[model samples]
Target: MSEAVARHWRSGHVDVEFLPVGAGSYHWRASTPKRPPLFVTVDDLDRKPFLGADADTVYARLRSALETARALRQSGMEFVVAPIEGRDGNVLSRIGRRYALAVYPYLGEPRAFGNALTAEERVALKAMLVRLHAAPKAVASLPRSVPAEVPFRRELELALDSVNTAWEDDQYSRAARPLLAANAAAIRGWLERFDELVRISSADNVDVVITHGEPHSGNIVRSGTHFALVDWDTVGLAPRERDLWLVGGGEPQLCELYRLRWRLDDLSSSVRVLLSPHDPDGDPERALRVLRISIEREPFTRD
Candidate 1:
């Protein structure tokens, strides 16, 4: 990884140290004598976000999103923590068959995943989101437009329907099968309510804009006195409510739609993980935990 980073970024020499910071990506802190430290991120282009996309397609979307962040920062929206371009004039470097890598200027520490946003922090994020929503034209490169609905609802449905059918021979999958069977009706109810909210979202007269899909406190950085957003991987065109829902001032029904999108998306992914052949290890165990939360979450309605 160190060799790859030094070669791609045209760096003198770097000593790399692994940092378990973000999910879905491997992170490292790269130190060079002459220059300040850099944050290096490597992702498996064949997994998760790459599910339907070929490696090339997923790579293109991620690179374009990061480039858009760079352009936004250049356009004076300094809150954008964009990826640094490699010497090849690309934001990402294809490390090997399975993995893709990118470099970024190491901003300081990000907040913990469970930490809630304070009132002032919420205000700051809301103001930043307003600027982001207003400036889709700042960057010539735009990512794919996503639907108003959550991405993984179908997967959730499939998991729920597989109640009678047994999961493959795996401990977690075995446990998940009965859980799904017991909660099938409640999951369906949540889905129905979600669809109802989607109708309201579809009828609303709202402008679509560039959104940082997961701009929760975990993705925000306190830069000096103000906050800046990191992780531009989820950047895309969507209704303003998608982001405004996170910070306040969004319409009630629209906000509820997005809120469901968030929980159901996580629930669905967790269900998919459990229904599939997941081993009894770190991620699979975590999926079981998330599955519990998804069904029991207040807004989701176990009834």
Candidate 2:
């Protein structure tokens, strides 16, 4: 993989040392002479396409993000970390048949927003969201908003089926079976409420904008003295609430400050927690514990 990355970097006439950085994606720190270090990410385009977007869709989204980032920076917002064009003038390069690569100037360590964000950081983040939301629609058009509860309901059904099937014969299910039975009532109630919320939100025609999608603190990096957002993979148009929910988690003051016109009452943070994907190969006992806690502590209620 490093060799492939080196070859790709040579195409741009950039001589740099690639050092493996961290997990999640194939990340590396590229050191170059006469320029700041660059952070490069290479991944299997076939297996891990950007946010499950097809090639054409992924390219269009990246192009739009790059354009928006440049425009935002030119408008005196230096904190926007846009992708740099390769020697071929493309923001993303197709490597072989299975791989795609993108490069950005290395930003410093990401800020950890543990538990809650500080008042000053919240103000800075709010300012950034205002600028992003106000930017002109750079992408041709945004993707249609799918109801969040659709997948949640599907997964809940699958989980219920799995638990039922396991109870029939699997020894591993012994630990989780009782827990599942205990929470069966609560799970069903949450599912019904989730379905209703989805129906209500889906029926409303809401305004959309180019959102950072997942703009939590982990994605916000502090480079030099300023903060810039990374991971444009999820960049697309959706209700401002999509991004606002990440920052405020339904906090009224922050949402109002951002001037969000859409209501987030239906989209609780617990929905994501409840519908989190489970690994088939993972430990069943551990998974049961997680599900138990998540369902027990869920904030949803039949009000």
Q: Per-prediction TM-score, please?
A: 0.89, 0.68
| Range of the 10 consecutive residues with the lowest summed lDDT in candidate 2 | 260-269
- lDDT accuracy of residue 177 in candidate 2: 56
In lDDT terms, how accurate is model 2? Answer: 0.53
Please report, in order, the local distance difference test score of every candidate based on alpha carbons: 0.77, 0.53
Predicted candidate 1 versus true structure: per-residue lDDT over 1-303, tens digit per residue: 889988988467789999878777888988888787888999877664523457777777777778878878878899998888888888888776678899988876545675677787788889899898888574634666767665667778887777797667687787777877888897788788888987776665766788887788888888788789998887888787777777767788877778777777878878767766443323778888788777776654211
Give the per-residue lDDT of model 2 (tens digit) for 1-303: 445444654333454455554323466667655767677877554333333446555455555555556555556667778777666666677666556677778775434432345565567777788777776543324333322423234444555556555433444446555655666676666556545554444545655666776566666776767667777665666556657864554434323322221212212222222334243423444444444445553332211
Best by lDDT: 1
TM-score of 1: 0.89
